[model samples]
Target: MDAKTCLEKLKLIGVLSFATVDTQGNPQIRNISAIHYEPDGMYFFTARGKNFCRELLENEKVQIACFEACPAKVIVRQPPISTRT
Candidate 1:
């Protein structure tokens, strides 16, 4: 899907799946709700001490996906980015 449509789908979905890796390198996916969709960048919240946090610290690469009832999907593959709000 296109960028605008993807963003709209994300907002409609509200919650999304964030995938990370355990120490052994297995895939771990979790449901997340604290997210903000910005024109310049997207924002999401998770505790710093959580496993998902550590996974990002250990491996910068992360995968994010959000799907809607219309069968629309948005997949993002990139390194982790941290910014103070």
Candidate 2:
């Protein structure tokens, strides 16, 4: 699906899964609702310090899996901005 369609589908559910690989190549999957989608890409909030945050900083390769009638996976890269400001 296109980014717009994919984003709309993801937003409809209001929740998504974020997966990352640690330095040792261990797969890390976690349920997340903090992801926001845009026409260009996705946006979200995270602290400057956190395992997930650190992981992303080290490796931008990540996945956004949203709960749907069927499973959907969206590969995400780059660090998400902190909305705390």
Candidate 3:
């Protein structure tokens, strides 16, 4: 599938499984619904005090997956983009 199609599917799915490694190098997974999609990439939100946020800030690497009825699983592996105002 193309990038556009994959993004559309993700948006439609809403919640996604975000996998990240903790400070101990242990795997962690959680369902996240706060997401925004762009043509180039996607964005997700997590509370600053949450383990998810800490993991992302510490590791920067993450894998996002979404499973639908047709089993269209999309695994995105990339470092989080930092934007400064």
Candidate 4:
């Protein structure tokens, strides 16, 4: 699927797993529900003092996975990108 289509699917899916790395280089995964899609890029929200928020601040590298069990199935791999929110 195209980038726009993939982003649309992400919105439709709503909640998805977001993975990040900590200072120790250990992988951490969390569920993120607040996601916004724009023409330029995708954005998500987290509280200021949250661990996940700190993780993002220290390491911008992250991954998102969307799983849909329906008529159609898709898995998109998004590269690591910096985010500020």
Per-residue alpha-carbon lDDT of candidate 3 for residues 6-81, written as tens digits (9 for 90 to 100): 7878877868998999888899999998888898778766778888888888788888888877756677776867
Model 2 poorest 10 in a row by lDDT: 76-85
Model 1's TM-score against the true structure = 0.79
Q: Which is superior by lDDT, 2 or 4?
A: 4
Candidate with best TM-score? 3
Q: Lowest lDDT 10-mer window, candidate 1?
A: 76-85
Which 10-residue window of candidate 4 scores lowest in summed lDDT? 71-80
**Model 1 CA deviation exceeding 4 Å by range:** 1-5, 83-85
Q: Rank the candidates by lDDT, best first.
A: 3, 4, 1, 2
How does residue 82 of candidate 3 score in lDDT? 88
Write down the lDDT of every candidate, Cα atoms only. 0.77, 0.71, 0.80, 0.77
lDDT of 4 at 50: 91
Q: Residues 1-85, candidate 1, lDDT per residue (tens digit)?
A: 5656566667887788989899998999999999898754567877887888788788878887876778655887767456332
- After superposition, candidate 2 runs with Cα above 4 Å error: 69-85
Residue 32 local lDDT, model 2: 74
**Candidate 1 whole-model C-alpha lDDT, 0 to 1:** 0.77
Q: In model 3, where is the ten-residue run with the lowest total lDDT?
A: 76-85
Q: Provide the global lDDT of candidate 4 against the true structure.
A: 0.77
